[model samples]
Target: MGKLRVKVDLALCQGHAVCMQEAPEVFRVNETDGHYPKVEVILEFPPEDLREKVMDAVRYCPNRTISVEEIPD
Candidate 1:
């Protein structure tokens, strides 16, 4: 399997946790008292086995802020 990188743009993200729900291993969103933080964190390199789910998260993002790219080892 190949390596992949994930990234999220906070400016474009509206606190939607779709990516988080789809790929919790790759994306994270902190919640506080029912309110979610504006920033979303993307893991640098998710497990190669999770590529399909990561791609699903990318497609599920409404703002299209999520990005996944294959990296050279």
Candidate 2:
């Protein structure tokens, strides 16, 4: 498998934190005082070993904001 590139659409994100729940190592939800929580990509290019969890994060995102692309090494 190739390296994985993960991205999140901030505009559409609703601070659900599902991605963080699914893949804590790759995704994080930042909660601010006034603003809505936002997702942070801790690992933009996670290793192949994390493909399954990363895909789970992508699949389970309620807003479908998370995206993953496979990059050839």
Candidate 3:
């Protein structure tokens, strides 16, 4: 399988944390003081083993802010 490049659109993220729930190893939801919570990509290029979970995050994101691109390995 090719490498996975994950991305999150912070402007569209509402901090639902669905992506985190789906793939904690690849995504993080940080809620800081005085700022709206946002989702962060913990692993921009996760291992092939985590591809399914990462894809789940992309598929289940409530705001549709998560995306993945396959890069030639």
lDDT minimum window of 10 residues, candidate 1? 32-41
Per-model tally of clashing residue pairs: 0, 0, 0
| Tens digits of per-residue lDDT for model 1, 1-73 | 4588887777787768888898888778776565546545657788878888889988988889888677877
Q: Residue 5, candidate 3: how far off, in angstroms?
A: 0.5
Candidate 3 residue-wise lDDT, 1-73, digit = tens? 6788998788999888898888999888999678778988888989989999998988888789988888987
lDDT of 2 by residue, 1-73 (tens): 6788998889988899999999999999999789889999999999888889999989999999999888987
Against the true structure, whose lDDT is highest? Answer: 2
lDDT, model 3, position 43: 89
Model 2, residue pairs in steric clash = none
Model 1 segments more than 4 A misplaced: 32-36
How are the candidates ranked when ordered by lDDT, highest leading?
A: 2, 3, 1
Off by over 4 Å in 3: none
Lowest summed lDDT across 10 adjacent residues in model 2 is found at 1-10
Candidate 3 global TM-score: 0.92
The regions of model 2 sitting more than 4 angstroms off are none
lDDT of 1 at 56: 94
